[model samples]
Target: MSRLIRGVGAVLLAGAVLGGCATHPNSEQALQQAGGDFQKVKEDANVLRFAPKDVIRAGESLARADRLSTYWGSGADVEHYAYLSRRYSAIAREHTEQGLNAERGARLELERQRLQLALRESKLSSVQQQGKWLEEQITSLATQTDRGLVMTLGDVLFDTGDAELKNSANRTVLKIVQFLQLNPKRVVRIEGYADNTGGEQENLRLSRDRAQSVADVLVDLGIDEKRIQVEGYGDQYPVEANASERGRAQNRRVEIVFSDAKGQLGAAR
Candidate 1:
């Protein structure tokens, strides 16, 4: 009879311990809600790719909540852990959104830079075409020479022993003025030469006076004076021998040299 009584007492003690360890319904519900939220966020593509660490932390919080409910039953500690799990899930979602927004901003900036570069290229092409048209106009009036494009006015254009130009040379002067007006960026150099028939001093003075006469005409035609350079090369740099009248005639002339686009003139060959 004493053995039976002792066994009943042991059974009562075991039941009491089991009842103390059992979880309350409210604690179980809280754990389920936290776990569901974490799972839902973790499955999202952005969160999985960009916020993987945050999502992992949320899952760990949920596991901790579950352990607390199993060991301590319905308690404040379980609820606290459940709240932490839900907060971590929210943080993961927020980080994912921030990362996506940053990526979109970077793409927009790159597109803006591309458009600016294209616009600059278009403007440069237009400028190059305009320069080509100006070149064509110059070619019509001048002949290409070793030094650059040159326009020559023979001794017939000027009076003998005088620096004044003849009336017949008006057309040539007009064409030159029109070209200069069209291309304001171009620079002109007026060079004068004389035949060997004259004395050295007299020939040099005459050549210089003729070059100055042409320079004055250009300035009067609305071309800037700064764009013209004048020089006299008496009986020097002759194109033909002075032994014949024809050769001497060719040597006594004025040459207008046009520089390249950058205002650079090549040396005479």
Candidate 2:
């Protein structure tokens, strides 16, 4: 009975030792197979940089699974597998995070660009169709040299104390831009003017600033900068005297001057 018990005990010990030894000896190979091997993974990593949405997810999965298998061994294969799995996991994670961030950023940027493009297109269409008077002035720059047409500061463009064009003015500017685009041979002169309420120097500065403001708006709207000549006329050329606030308000404006063969034609600043 004692010998029989000892024999059974020895068999059980052997089985346990065999079981321990039997662990997937080739876990490295297993990992390689599961993870698509290192060379395959390197290629996958390279493609992940610019790969479309579907490919990135697939590679990440394969690399992750293979790496875990490599982690399970006790021999050199074990450390090697473990290293492979760890390294692959890190790379996979890094690629995923970077890719996600970049994708999100690109999506947001694309949406913004689309909105901007639409706004520009809308402004161009609406303004060009409606502003017949404005279009004529801008389009006939070279031919209508001496015909002086005056539009008050409050009537055509710009806002109070701001260089930026209001949406309404932007619409007008957009119309002018399209007109100029159609008539590339034409040239425009932008003049800035200010009321006599301020000192002469200040008035000149303000006038010039306002004129440049108009030119800037037009430029941003797609008109060529070289086609526009900017000038500032202080209170010296005001249509209204500096006696009343209303008169002063009328004087604070930009004029777009057109040089016809004969002389000045339309004033739109």
Candidate 3:
């Protein structure tokens, strides 16, 4: 009976030793992982700046886990503290990323506003010089007609069959935007026309799309939509015969008709 009791005691002791052995490696691994995480957050400048308290807590917990790892039968406690350390480190990293993103967004917004202001000031500073040049250019590009002062945007400003205005049109568009800004009370009607090669309905749709595209750009550049009117004349009023490519090119055009100084516009065709 004594031998049986001794055998049972020895088996129980071995089982306990095996259980401790199983937990030991896991606890050591947890501690190493936690230490690595804590070290990374401690070294990161942004993490320190954004989450100093969380980083400090992570370091404290890692230290406690490291100390507990040296004691016997403290595997569970070591792993618990290590988990806490890793969680704190993860939280610190997350907070740092969020803070950095917010800072970046704010900086970008400030840069955008500053650039806009600089552009406005630059335009204002050169207004007199630009105004003289713009007047001469406008006089050359426009004519005094019964429809008021009409400026023509030729087919060269857009691709064949496309409603989009090309980058080459930037100079003329900018001049118009500046002109309208200078004459605040003056409004303009943008009329689009297409050659008669396509079907009538298709020409009408393309012409309208082209006109709307111009108006969209003007609005994007700070022009009020209410101050601008858009119209599509299609292939009805051709300035040149469409028998040749050159003449067709001439027929496909956009016309900007400016209102008088009193904001009175002529009749639309």
Please identify model 1 stretches exceeding 4 Å from their true place: 1-33, 70-75, 105-113, 140-147, 151-256, 260-269
Over 28-137, each residue of candidate 1 has an lDDT whose tens digit, in order, gives: 67777898989889789988988898898889888887777655444566777888998999999899999998999899889889989999999878766765665675
lDDT of each: 0.79, 0.60, 0.87
Clashing pairs in 1: none
- Number of backbone clashes in candidate 1: 0
Candidate 3: tens digits of C-alpha lDDT, residues 1-269: 99999998886566455533344889878988999999999999999999999999999999998777766578899899999999999999999999999999999999999999999998887886777787677878799998999998886876668899889888888888888887788899999999998889989988888888888888999899999999998888999999989889887788999898789999898
The 10-residue segment of model 2 with minimum total lDDT is 142-151
Whole-structure CA lDDT of model 1: 0.79
TM-score top scorer: 3
Q: Which stretches of candidate 3 lie over 4 Å from their true place?
A: 1-133
Which residue runs of candidate 2 sit more than 4 Å off their true CA positions? 1-164, 259-269
Alpha-carbon deviation at 39 in model 3, angstroms: 80
Q: How many residue pairs clash in each candidate?
A: 0, 8, 0
Model 3 clash pairs are none
TM-score result, candidate 2: 0.42
**Candidate topping lDDT:** 3
Model 2: how far is 67 from its true place, Å? Answer: 84
Angstrom error at residue 8, model 3: 99
Full candidate order by lDDT, most accurate first: 3, 1, 2
